[model samples]
Target: MFTGIIEATGVLKELTLKGGDLALRVQSHNLDMSDVQLGDSIATNGVCLTVVAKHSDGFSADVSNETLGLTRFSQYQKGQKVNLEKALQATSRLGGHLVSGHVDGIAEIVSSNSNGRATEYWLQAPENLMKYIPYKGSVAIDGISLTVNAVEKNRFKLTIVPHTAQETTIADFKVGTKVNLEVDQISRYLERLIQGQSSAASESTLTTGLLAKAGFIK
Candidate 1:
């Protein structure tokens, strides 16, 4: 689990294609590497990546084909900047909403505009994932916890402040940029509960056709 709070911005130093999967080496000058160990998980651009190897500057992890196809990591090139966050600790403060670092789907930045000291961006999400996003809901965009300012059709709005831009990779966003999106974990759980109950109700409904088919009544 994670807090969706970006600790630092890291640069992709190398992307080596080992066999069929790719191995990534990220270099970060700001992120603390003292406590990080092998097998530890790091949220990289909202995707949970396990640390296979660690160095003084950064760490290296392997990316599977499924993750590559589902995320923008496939489009990433060497030297690209990425947001970084360590896994949440039991004693860590819950500053942001719970983020699984599991990318639900990718979203494309449709538009952006300056809003005084902040920049407001509108992004179009995958059609099936839009129902999980609600106005004023919490979302993790590329591992940065942000609130949904508005929702229109299949698009949602986010207001990025100067601090956020300077601290993470939000400053690099542009129209047509693809980003990993993780909706509120609670929302997904609630949806599952509702669906489960609906399914049970439908199965228990006794229609005349169902009764006749089952030979229970005629």
Candidate 2:
């Protein structure tokens, strides 16, 4: 789990594909990786990845084929900047809402504008993923937790302050760029429960119909 509070911007040093999996070598810029150990989970661009190898600059993690296809990591290249955050510790502060570091889907940045220090970003998400993009709701974009400034159908806008821009890689977003998105955990859990109940209700209705058709009900 994570808070979506980005601690630093990291650089992608190398990305190697071996045995149909991705091995990422990154260079942490001012990110403290000393506390990270092998097998530790970390969020890179809002995707929870396990540390396979460690170094002074950064650690390497293996990305499965499913993860690659589901996330924007497939589009990343060497030298690209990425947001980094350590796993949520028990003693850590909840500066942002509950983020699972699990990317639900990718969103496309329709427009990005910066004035002096603040930034305004408008992105279009998938209909299935827009349930959590309510106004003032918590959404983690590329590993940085931000509030929705406004929402329109499957699109939403965000206002990034100077501290967020300077501390994270969101400042590098451009129009047409893709980003990893993690919805609020509360919303996800609630959605899951609602879907479960709906499915159960549908199954019960189907059973009743079957019974009536078989002359069990008059």
Candidate 3:
């Protein structure tokens, strides 16, 4: 599991897609590699990938075919910047909400506004995600946890402060760019609650009508 918090940024070195498996190599100077071993899971742009190899300047992970089909990581090109986060440790703080480090789907950046200190990423999600995004809801974009600053039709905006931009690659957002999106987990819980309430209401109404016909109640 991850907290959707980005720790650093890296430049893509290789996206080797062969035999239906993807091997990504990226250069991150901030990641302390001295302790990282092979087979460790790292969150790359919100996708939890296992480390296949490690080097002084970078590491590589095998991306499953399913992950490639579902996320924008497959669209990454050489030298592109990407968000990076290490897997959550037992001792790490749970700053953000529970995140599986799984990319549900890709969302498109509709617009952007940049100031020197901050940049805003406006994105349009698919129809399936429209009901999940709400005002002040938590969202993970390319693995960075952010709040919904504003929402439009199938669209939402996130304001990236300078600190967040520096830690991740969100400062480079541009129109038409694709990003991995994960909605708040609480939204699913809410849906379940609504379904349960509807079921209870239907049963109550049926019982009431039966009782009235039998003269047990008016």
Candidate 4:
């Protein structure tokens, strides 16, 4: 698991293709790797990758085809900057929301604008994943944990402060830039729990009508 707190911006030094999988070597930048072991997991742009090899300044991980298909990593090129976050330790503070580093889908930046000292970005998410996104909820965009400022249909808005923009790769985002998105884990678990209960409930169906009847909606 990760905290979605980006520790540094790393560079994709190389990508060697082996069959359908890829071996990626990334420059660690300012990320401390002294405690990182060979089997440790690192969240690279919100995708959890296991450390396969260690180097003086970086590490390498193997990327499966399934991960590539679900994330924007397939579009990444050598020298591209990526957000990096080490796995959360038990003693570490929960600075951001819990992130599994499992990319649910890819989202595209539709628009961007300045909001006082912060930059607000409007992104369109995959239609299948829209139900998991909610206004005022948490979403990890390219590994940066941010709050949803607003939600409209399959799109949502996020506001990032200057510090966040400077410390992570989010500052480089532009219109149409693709990003890895991980929705709140709690939402997925709740959906599963509801589905399980609904399967057992005969008249107590679970649907939009049920939500409205329960006063969860107006």
Candidate 5:
């Protein structure tokens, strides 16, 4: 798991293609790697990648085809900047929301505008994923945890402070830029619980009418 708090920004140093996978090497830019080790998980642009090799200034990880298909990794190029966050430790403070580092879908920046010291960005999420994004709720965009300022049909707005813009890759975002998105994990679990209960109820004699008769509903 990750806290979605970007520790630093890294550059994609190289991308090597193997059979059906990709080997990624990223150069750390001020990110502390003294505690990192081989086999440790790192959240690169919101996608959890296991470190296969470690160097003085960077690390290498292998990206499978399945992860590539679900994320914007295919669109990345050498020298591109990406948000970087180390996996959360039990003793670490919960500065940001809980992030699985699992990209649910890709979202595109629809618009951007300066909002005084902050920048308001509107992003269009996938139709199916929009249900998970709610106003005032949390969403991780390219590994940076942000609150949804507003929500439209299939889009949501986020206000990025100057500190966030400088700390992460959000400063480099532009219209049409694709970003990896991870919705709130709690919402997903709640949906599954509700759905499972509904399914079980459908098979039994419990119905809305019965509940109303029992004064459970008005």
Candidate 6:
């Protein structure tokens, strides 16, 4: 699990083909790598990647075919900047909402405009995932936790402050930029619970007319 809080920014250094999958190296001068070990997970642009090899200035991880299909990783270019966040520690602060680092889908930036010291952006999410994005709800874009300022159709708005833009790769956002998106974990669980209960209730003998007779409805 991750907190969706970006710890530093990293650059894609190299891409190597390993077997049928791809291995990529990320270099960051600001991120702490002193205690990192093999098999540790790191949230890279909101996608959880396991550490296969550690380096002095960066690390290498293999990207599976499933991840490439669900995220914008396939379109990434060499030297592109990426958001970086280490997995949550036991004593870590809950700075952002719980993020599984399992991106649901990709979202595209529809528009980008300046809002005083902040940058206001409109992004179009996957139609199926739109239901999970509510006004003022939490969402992780490229692994950076942000609040939804507004919502319309399949699009949502995010107001990125200067600090956020400077600390992460959001500053590189532009119209049509594809980003990894992860919705709040709680919403997904609630949806499953509701669906499961509804499915079980299908065998009930009570109906709307029965509810009216019982004074539960008018």
The TM-score of candidate 3 is: 0.81
TM-score of each: 0.89, 0.87, 0.81, 0.91, 0.90, 0.89
Per-residue accuracy of model 6 over 25-89 as CA lDDT, tens digit each = 99999999998999999999999999999999989999999998999898888998999999999
**Candidates 1 and 2, the one with greater TM-score:** 1
**Candidate number with the higher lDDT (2 or 3):** 2
lDDT of 1 by residue, 48-165 (tens): 9999999999999999998998888999999999999999999999998999988999999999999999999999999878777889999999999999999999999999999999
Off-target runs (Cα >4 Å) in candidate 3 are 114-117, 189-218
Between candidates 4 and 6, name the one with more favorable TM-score.
Answer: 4
Clashing pairs in 1: none
Q: Model 5 over residues 1-218: C-alpha lDDT tens digits?
A: 99989998899999999887899999995888899999999999999999999888879999999999999999899998989998999999999999999999999999999989999999999888887888899999999999999999999999999999998999889998989999999877655555466575453343457546656568
Q: For candidate 4, give the lDDT of residue 9.
A: 85
Please report, in order, the local distance difference test score of every candidate based on alpha carbons.
Answer: 0.91, 0.84, 0.80, 0.90, 0.90, 0.90
Winner of 1 and 6 under lDDT: 1
Can you list the residue pairs that collide in candidate 2? none
Q: Output the TM-score of candidate 6.
A: 0.89
Model 5 regions more than 4 Å off: 197-218
Clashes of each: 0, 0, 0, 0, 0, 0
lDDT of 1: 0.91
lDDT of 2: 0.84
- By TM-score, the best candidate is 4
lDDT of 3 by residue, 1-218 (tens): 88888777888888887787778798899877777889987888888888889989879888888888898866778898877788888999999777778787789998888767778878999977767788888988888888898998889988889888767777677899888998887665545554466575452233345546656568
Off by over 4 Å in 2: 114-117, 197-218
The number of clashing residue pairs in model 3 is 0
Residue-wise C-alpha lDDT for candidate 2, range 1-218, written one tens digit per residue: 88988888788899999898899987885879878899998889989999999998888899999899989888889998888888999999999978887789999999878766788989999987786677989899998899998999999999989888788886677898888888888865654554466475442232335546656567
What is the lDDT for 117 in model 1?
96
Runs of candidate 6 with Cα error greater than 4 angstroms are: 197-218
Determine which window of 10 residues in candidate 1 has minimal summed lDDT: 201-210
